[model samples]
Target: MQKYSERKNSAIDKTANPESGNVQPKPRRRRTAVNRGLDENGNGKRKPRRQARRSRSGGFKNTFLLTGIEILGLSVAAVCAVIMLLGYSAGRFSGTSFFGHLLPFTAGVLVLIVAAALFLLGWWKLRQWLRRYSEFLTPALSLSLALLTPWLVTHDQFTLAYGNFRTLVGGKEEAGRMTISHQVYAAYRRHDAAQLQKMVNRAQEYRQAIEDAARSFAVDAHLLHGIAATESSFIPRDSHDGGRGLFQITRVPETVIAQARKRLNVEKISLDDPRHNAFVAAATFKHYLAEMKDDLFLGLLAYNIGPANGGLRFIMQQYGATDFTTIQPYLQTLPRDYPIRVLAYSLAFRLWQQEGRLLAYEEGNNAIRIQRIGIPGLRAGL
Candidate 1:
């Protein structure tokens, strides 16, 4: 019986053994919470750690970008606002006396600060409201404000304000410029309207020639017209002073004549021909203008003086004169007021071109308006 029982157990062991030819299959592994990517208690699956960090970092970058854009927009708007408001305030508070100007200016600045703070608060609320509709609203509003500021400055009140601001900040050079400019204004005021009107009418025929020459030499046409008006009154004649044609063609440098010849593409220059006369005049003026370092007043004076007496440079050096102001006393024999008269005439021409009539300086607010229009060849403020 024991041997039979042992034989049955041996038969079962052979069936379970891998070395035996008849083999049984192995059992499958049981599933668990850890293998299924869940906690031991069978909770929700955990996300990848790297993926979670990436999501938070992306959110932070987006928030930082938005904050930077907002700050940039606000700063631009603030800068533009400050420039315009400060310009206006400085204009209003300008006074000759130190304390008189300082006290009022300080008070105005304080008021502006308060006003700006209130404006910023209101803008912040508006920005918040606008952000709900569109994320780009803040930048758009800032761009619009920048564009609007330039247009606002073009208005008469703002124009005056800008001029006052320049005056306040300007140094001795500016003071000298203002003094000379006022002289031109006085000369313009003295001109008879009828005579000036006749001169403008006479210039119509020569306008094409003058403008062509001006373009060829990169000169201001209105300024050339002033030179013509002062020289021949647009009459174009041979003078007793050895001057010929419309510009009172005096002695011009050989280089100027050569440049004029090159520009006209002609073998010979004829002062009788209005075109040739204008080209020569333009070249001559350009030469002197460069020699004088583009100082308009000095250039005009040099043009009027021509190369006579070793030119204006030599004359200035002889008297130890440095600028237009210092050279005036030494010009007893020369036409010291030539530049002023020319500029005055140029201003008249500009006024006629813009307003269709010459503005009388003594007329109500006409002086300011004309000044705002500015002299030709000179840059206008604002």
Candidate 2:
């Protein structure tokens, strides 16, 4: 009994001594309401609440700063894109300029790069928008906007409408002067890029003669040059319609030819000679211009379709019209496109003579040979 009691006391001692290495761990102290801003009543405590409010305020400030920075970046990009696009569309830096070639070339290339970057960014944004929206709505809205873009830009802002995909890539310039040649416009309508190319290329060969004739008649050399281009593309030929030579003299009375010869002080004149042809064409144009009371459109029309289609006077009298626009509707019945064609060619030649190229964008492209001043020895004969 004594031994049994001693053993039990030893076991008790061992249990109480944690150094024996067989002790149970103490209970963990649970965090109370005050530690996490909660009170005994379960309401949020003031100290922790203030700290949380401060944290939220800091987060909001950071977010606002980030948003502002994003907006600023986007605004700068937009401004740059617009400037570049404007420069590109207005042809401010292609071919040649009054400001200087190097300036335009450098500026054009830089603007093109910026415009390209902006276009790429916009394309990416468009893709993102498409992804963010429903499939049906995205395509439908995008298509509608795309279709409307050209129409709105062309009609409202003429100069800024020089995008590659626009209806009028070159813009509606020289509208009033477009009626100077019929054959040129016909070629344009037919999309005869080859013949059109020839017109400019051959201009250099007969340029001197055209200039002299125009000077004699007190006419814009480019205008007369345009007429020759339209009539024959500077190639001497006879048409089945009875048109002949560089000017394609068709129905001029013998008396008028004799009078022209006398006025030019040339005893023997042949339509085959470019110089003579240019003189005759200029004289004819002058006579018709006076006959139609100096109405350029009417004069040009009479030269193209002949005065016999009731003449410009009879047509104007019949329609009670005074201006081209007023008479335009009736003109469709005749060779109205003739004048427009002449004008287009004339305008192109004028641009070439002034800027050393056909268009502001014609440089570096294979569209037309802008630098073809004629064959090296071709000018010798003239």
Candidate 3:
């Protein structure tokens, strides 16, 4: 029995120790401290902790993505803001090519679109606090800026822009109907104020001749002055395709000259004489005025292009039009814009006479400030 017990014990030890060259099943590994914490139901209490760690990592990634997006949206909005500000300056909108005129409007619309898009993006990507403010702030600011744009642009001495803005508001139709002279005056005022001032001063030298011509032919002295200024820049011997002398008089047939001289009751007329030139110009304007039945627009046009193609009768019979607006389109090769230039110079002369000093058309601080007054049917006329 003792021998049998020893053999059985040896067999058990061999089974326990596989290295003894006996075939035996391998022992299972002992559970680590972490695994030992699991409950008996096969569900680990620590599983929720692992899940929480994964959720935290994913949340951090989402936050970083949103931050990048918000930065991108804000950057675009900043660029749009700069564009809007430039558009509101109103410098690029006048007397330019069609593309130039369109630039401000197009830029404004584009900026508005970008601002709106940013506002929408902010709704999703911005932080909670930032998003709350961005929702209404973006659109409100954009709309307010747009509404103020025209007023801000009109505050400058940009004459064309001022007129355009006035027209837009629909209170002053006359401002929109700027004569050719107004455009030229604005150009000279902006680019060559000194030159304009010099011309006005030199006009005084011919004041006596202009006065004599006005009295002889019953023309306005300011009209003669403005015509001379517009035609020759107050230079007595200025010559052009129109002819020679201070008035830029076109040479007529000897018979026509004699007839004009008879009508004016003047003798010994010379084109070179400043007084004679002024007298002839006044007489010619008067003749055209009479020929056109006192139609001012046609008379002015005929003085430049002659009665054959101009004047009230010819324009009415040929083009079936009676008003200046209708005849303007048919004018060409006769300095159609000359009257506008002359008229504009006339206005400047009047202003100078009134103020005793020319006002510098400063860009930001201009003299033409049209008060906003609501007029019924003003916008409809446009």
Candidate 4:
């Protein structure tokens, strides 16, 4: 009985040590990764400690926040710009189909809403919180949008659009710039359908001449229109400021006029008749633009404010600056938006051409021309 009882106790002990066959010592409990932490109410209970909150990378934190804010702002601005562009686009294509009215109206309303949202965000919740966002995101967003530009430009509509975009002075030239500039288009321009239509029609009259000039200067037609509009309202009338016709070209000093007449074997040009006046004006503007090596704005300033020789000296002195963007504050009221107005007209002309408002003359084709000759050259052979 004693031997049996001893054997039973030993058997029970052997069963309890299930892994005794293995030679390794009993494994240790894996130390919990988290140290013991206080419970929710600060009581001692089984709780996990966090991993020290990633050590608070202050610089990274600030940068991330700033990036987020900048993205938000740029997104808003981009939407606003697209909306405003749609507005102008609406008024531009107003007489078309049902989609036309719907497009512009929706665009106009959306532009206002986007602009208002940006304004509110800037004024209310994100004034300072997102200040760094603009700084950080502007360049990055510009780069991202710029990547799409080449692709956008390659499309037929956007190719024509890119050609037209090259003509606007202060407006957005690409998608990135559009993000910020859409706000300006919305706030400043009213998109008057009638005025735009008239301006478009007026631009048609001199389309050939401007196109010719553009080819000559390797310049944009819309820019030429802007200059012409400011200089003479495309009326080809004389300037009250001793300037000539379409581009408001001024007479050479009487002495210079005499010399030019002798040199070119020409007579004094009349400044009253619109056509002749436009001829002289465009030629003279071409000369000035040439002299400036196509610094169009300076040439224009010379046209309006009178440049000494090529208008460089006065431009530097009066505007108190060298950059074009900085010129606005230094200018007198005689010509406001001096650059932008001309740029607008130039852009308008480009739009007309893209939209087929201008007849293609194919360089020298006479299918659409009415040339005057002593012997009726147009009917001579036929």
* Top candidate when judged by TM-score against the true structure: 1
> Which candidate model has the greater lDDT, 3 or 4?
3
TM-score of 3: 0.45
Q: Which stretches of candidate 4 lie above 4 Å from their native place?
A: 1-189, 213-219, 238-244, 251-266, 273-275, 287-293, 308-312, 315-320, 334-336, 357-382
RMSD of each: 8.3, 22.3, 22.7, 19.1
Ranking by lDDT: 1, 2, 3, 4
TM-score per candidate, chains pooled: 0.77, 0.45, 0.45, 0.40
Better of 2 and 3 by lDDT: 2
- Ten residues in a row with the worst lDDT in model 2? 373-382
Per-residue error at 35 for model 4, in Å? 94
Model 2 alpha-carbon miss at residue 314, Å:
2.2
Summed over model 4, clashes come to: 5
Q: After best superposition, candidate 1 residue 22: deviation in angstroms?
A: 21
Best by lDDT: 1
The alpha-carbon lDDT assigned to residue 131 of candidate 3 equals 51
Q: Candidate 4, overall lDDT?
A: 0.50
Residue-level lDDT tens digits of model 1 in 206-256: 999999999999999999999999999999999999999999998998899
Question: TM-score of predicted model 1?
Answer: 0.77
Model 1 segments more than 4 A misplaced? 1-84, 106-125
lDDT of 4 by residue, 1-382 (tens): 9999999887767666766552445578774424345454556655224433443566678777766765665565555345335534543554536676666666666767787778657644544544455645443553465456445434344333332333232244333333323332332244454666676777677777666645544544556676776666666655577676666666444443343344334576555544444444445555555655565555555455554443544656655775444565666564635644565444445445554543232335321121110011011110
